[model samples]
Target: MLDAAVFQGLSWNLLDDFRQLFTYPFMVNALEAGTIVAVMAGVTGWFMVLRRQAFAGHTLSVIAFPGAAAAGWAGVPLALGYFGFCGAGALVLAAIAGTRRSLGAESAAIGSLQALALALGFVFVSLSHSILTGLDSLLFGTFLGITRSQVLVLLVVAVATVAVTAFAARPLFFASVDSDVARASGVPVRLLGLGFLLVLGLSVAETSQITGALLVFALLVTPAATAHRLTPRPWLGLTLAVALALAVTWAGLALAYFSIYPVGFYVTSLSFGVYVLVRIVTR
Candidate 1:
């Protein structure tokens, strides 16, 4: 998969691209919004990769879709509805399993919720007056339509997510790497797990707005997975993950603007490609 010719042609210079980026208001908005989402996803996704909670992240995204659709049908803000629903689902999972269940059981619950959410989203779409295009957009995403207000909202979420993650980093890491040891050492493993789930829920809900629920996994998994493969150092892994996420989001946005496909498609494809490359190299 390593293409020497393509690698050779890729330019790192930003000056030429800088003007192109600022020439359009949509591009600016996309960049700002994408960067904010990337930072949050990157930080939380690092723990997600380490803890093997990728399935939970995916389930949260799937559940958010129906919530967004229902919100749209009711003429409310989609983000709030999406977060509320996914957060509730996260809470339910935490309560039922006590955040200490085996991976097999967790996976089973996530799978069930994923299916249920998609079914509900489809049913809502069928009953609503809105066309399939709107629902489809929420599923696959369309960054070109993002407004400046949305960008501002993204910034706020990003800041809050990053701040919380920073403060919770030590205990979160301890619990994720070894919950038994953490709990033995007097760490509130259950509480930590629930808090992380809440953060994951919010991140997935916000990202679903930009990349859609189906494609949110790309942002939530790829960069962190790649970073984990490249290094075992926690801080280094997080740094690499954030950098990779930012690069993919910015590059993907540029490619989408220049291509015919939607931004989510390009972003997901790019992220998957990077993960594949990292896997190959690490192997």
Candidate 2:
């Protein structure tokens, strides 16, 4: 919901430039939503990387494209399309896992789904006239038109995601680390995997609303990947991922507010920069 036309310049005074970030109610809502998104994406993304499901996460993001396009074509709420398609995509991926997780199966399933989704997205885009005006936001995301209600919706979803993640943390980690051992220990690995994909789907959908479909994956994966490179310990990685995500989201929002750039580029660049820095330091 960023206004592509607005160009708010930053003043030389550091304090004034920072203060102007909160001048509009929309900025406040964007910050709140970004904060919520950073937390949920960071936590879930940590597990997602550990479980080697980045491909699945990418596929889900691809699905969001058509989901939004179809919503536009139908004159319906984009949120509904996003959540509905993403949740269903998660289900399909989970179903392919069957009674156990198979890396091969997941890859093939994600590949097919991604291909189909891209095709459908193009078809929908061609059919939907209304979507073109907001195509940039749909693809890259914006922080311009966030309302109080949307922020409230993000809050509710974020709370649920955090609560479920907390409740399932132990078993989920065990399963993600070693599904065979966790299953032998009666951890219900398949169920946990299903639940995780669902949570991930929701996270993708929620983030896509603010960060755009394509860029949300970076928010979900980059910070976690950076944290993983920084620490081998699970808790530290989790904490670091959340911290990094929050930092990049806030920085990206502020920079985009003051310059002529898409918020997605700023976020992606910041996250990648941190990731590269970690890679260098660790080497």
lDDT of 2 by residue, 1-283 (tens): 3455445586789898888888778888999999999999999999999998899998888888889888888888777888898999999888877735567765876799899998998898888866743888888988877789888888998899889998999999999998789999999888898999999999998888878999987699999999999999999999999999999999999998888788888998999999999999999
User: Tens digits of per-residue lDDT for model 1 on 145-214?
Assistant: 5688888887887788789889989999999888889999999988888888888888898888888889
lDDT of candidates 1 onward, in order: 0.82, 0.88
The model with the greatest lDDT is 2
* TM-score, every prediction: 0.90, 0.95
- Clashing pairs for model 2 are 1-144
Each candidate structure's count of clashing pairs = 0, 1
Show the colliding residue pairs in model 1.
none
